[model samples]
Target: MEENKNKVVELLKQYMSTPENEPSRGISYLKEAVFILNGQGKTLAAHEILEKELRKFHDNSTVEMAILLNMMIKLSALVGDFAGAVEYSRRAQAICEAKNERELLTKVIINTSGLYFKMKDYDKALMHANKALQMAKRNGDEINAACCLNNIAIIHENGETGESGIPYLEEAVKIKEKHGMNAELPSSYVNLAELYYESERKAEAAELLEKARTIAKANENEYAIVEAMKYEARFLKGEGDLASAINLLEEVREYHQENGNKTELLGVLNDISSVYELMGDSKEALNTFKQITELSRSIFKEEQARSIAQLESSFEAREKLREINDLAEQNKRLRTVNEEISEKNNELQEMKAKLEEINRLLEKQAETDPLTGLLNHRKMKSVLDSEISRAERYETPLTMIMLDLDDFKSINDCYGHLKGDELLAAIGKLIRSSIRKNDFAFRYGGEEFLILLPSADMQRTTEVYSRLKESLREHLEIAVSFSAGAKQWKGESSDEFISIVDKLLYEAKAKGKDRLETSEAAI
Candidate 1:
């Protein structure tokens, strides 16, 4: 490790000393250093170096900048910053498209597909993956073609179709093996093993898993090794070898934790929890669940911090630009005071527009739930209060629905909180699309949502509920149902209104879930 660190330091020094005009040469050195650092499991270090170097290149359209941005996208995704990765990918995609850099564009598209995959947007993921595959095939880029195939296969595997990805993955593995792509072999093998296991071809699955482990070990690919082990542990658990599965998962968890790979660590912890549950160790399972929750929160907080840092950096850049403009105005004052005033006014207008845009983004951030993209609890109270006031004053009917996911805890317990979050996000999108423009939806809290409909009584509100149910049935990949309580406002305070609806929601759950409960009396 020390030797690798020294090698990285030397490479970075060489890169820094390279002439500014020869950016390609400098980027080559930087890439080498990054490769070494990432191989050492120092991905954060690699990202930091890339970010520092990226700031030196002001022209985003440059090939060097696009390459650096692509690297950042991958590292950000690895570190569980899907939002940041998507932002970087968009910039990279724009640059590549404008420059007609198909090579970089293919990379960007594939990486974007990966980001969507991690976020569980299977439809988009599949779309992008297939697009990248076509592009790769057109360019006769065998390696990228194989990668695209692998991505597509995984998307199909995890998607709602319950279709086997064996064909796609088999093609990918064959391509890699034919090309002697040893580094890529293990992942393909492991993925194939998973499909084999799911198909109940246990012998083939075990053989593929062992091959993956052996190849990964020979390649000294720590990530691939742990990935292979993860699946092996799953197979062990499925075979009822609970003790061995737990031990293997613990080892996998240690590796992810040591590498600061929080995303994979979350998966490891979830697997551990599942194993414990299988072992009938409820106490241990709950403890593991708590750990997953805390780790998820930590990852969320880190992403938030990075966002704030980016905002601060943007503000600082604008401030510097303003200072430079002011200095130019002072120099131009000798020529004409009016001209200076006019230019200064124009600059002020630009600054005002920028500030307003920033304020809009900040406001949205404050009001929206990060996971679900719905109005959060922070905005819920004020919006509800205002709507209630409007309804009372105009004598228009207003209805609110409080809905909770049925068997949400079991979903979380069975599939982990990450899957639960995906379900909630899907439901949030469904609710948004199901409601009218005048209606409002908020992620009231965990596994619960609130919707407010203006100029609508219980009947209209029930219609909205029916629409949501139908939408969920058509769009959702998983089987999920929500119980809701809808009630017409009765000239009461917002708190009273919400309380009444909450009680009805509980009544729906008590009367056997997956149905709507509403006040039967007329307004």
Candidate 2:
């Protein structure tokens, strides 16, 4: 590796001294820079070598200079150095525009749009994406047009509704299909599926998701597979399947974690912890959050280390240059300078290690029924939305049960509100223990509580409700029996299911409480 690096450096230096138009010499050097010391892992080292070579040559209108600039643009973006990417892109764009090279300009513009997208400047991203799409379409370039269409959709996705992005995704998918761009199709399909999801078209979204998964697997595209998994996890999250979603996300999390891709790892961890919190699993959430805080701090420490390393490296380089110049004047001073620099380097290493240990303790507490430690009303509502989507996709039988303490005001009057509150808390605990892991038990404000059981029939749900009531009666010191009403899901929205069960609960109370009533599907 050291020999090859020295050889490339010598070749670049030889080429740099030659004239700009020296018959493929400049292009050859750029190609050597790309292929030999290509900046995959050691980007900074590659960038420094390439930059030194680049600075040696004067600016020119030759195709070679253009190729060098474009390569630099891509390499800069590859290393997350967007500022360098923009500057290199601007230089390339100037050459392309000056030469009236529409095709090259279109490609550069598309790349610029992508850079802006990474920068999160949606308006500028949209502007460039639109320009590139138009040029690609005008010139009959299906590949870039398809890519631009996808970019436009992504930029539009920043909108709240995501409705406006639908057309662009559809068009992009259509173009990809037309050209048989299988490598690119998965991303378009995934994007379109998400927009369809926003529009509440579950079957369409499901079909697209399946297509994306199949193609991604066949192509063995790791990035495409990971991206597909991210959307699938998100869909599952929306479907009220938190455990499954978390499992899927953990795969993605592990992939990024093992690869040392800290940015993506941070994103996946945030999603995992947020879902944990929403599922009323506070301990899991806090654990995930703790991981996030540690990773974030580690990233910060590396960045700080790089900054300090650069300053020290600069100082050392200048000191060595000075020592070489002053060799004739004094040789003894060089040893002292080296000793002082070594001590400073040691201090910097200590500081870097200290920075790594500094972490933000960002602990998240789950919102629960404080007394019973069960899910509160808000979290339950989130669960309902997620579960309803899940039920729709799997055609699963879901049952919603609403239970009210019988004549709770009268009970409060008889035993005092304190005893009533204790009974409610006890009932919450009982419900929490009785339900399945997938089931959600929520305190629905005041004396009423709700339970959602997915993939369960009406009879089984009623039995579970009866068992819970029996358990409560057996365990409590005072005699206690509550009224409950359950309604099975039959292609109804979450609000409809909730309302039907609520009405049935009211019927049980009117019929003299201490009974369970289930609403028939026909009603």
Q: Pick the candidate with the highest TM-score.
A: 1
Highest-scoring model, lDDT: 1
Q: What are the per-residue Cα lDDT tens digits for candidate 2 across 325-344?
A: 77836766776787799999
For model 2, how many clashes? 2
Mind sharing the TM-score for model 2? Answer: 0.50
**Candidate 2: C-alpha RMSD after superposition:** 12.3
Residue-by-residue lDDT tens digits, candidate 1, 143-223: 899999999989877875333467789999999999999888998999989877754567999999999999888877778
lDDT of 1 at 212: 92
Candidates' C-alpha lDDT: 0.85, 0.75
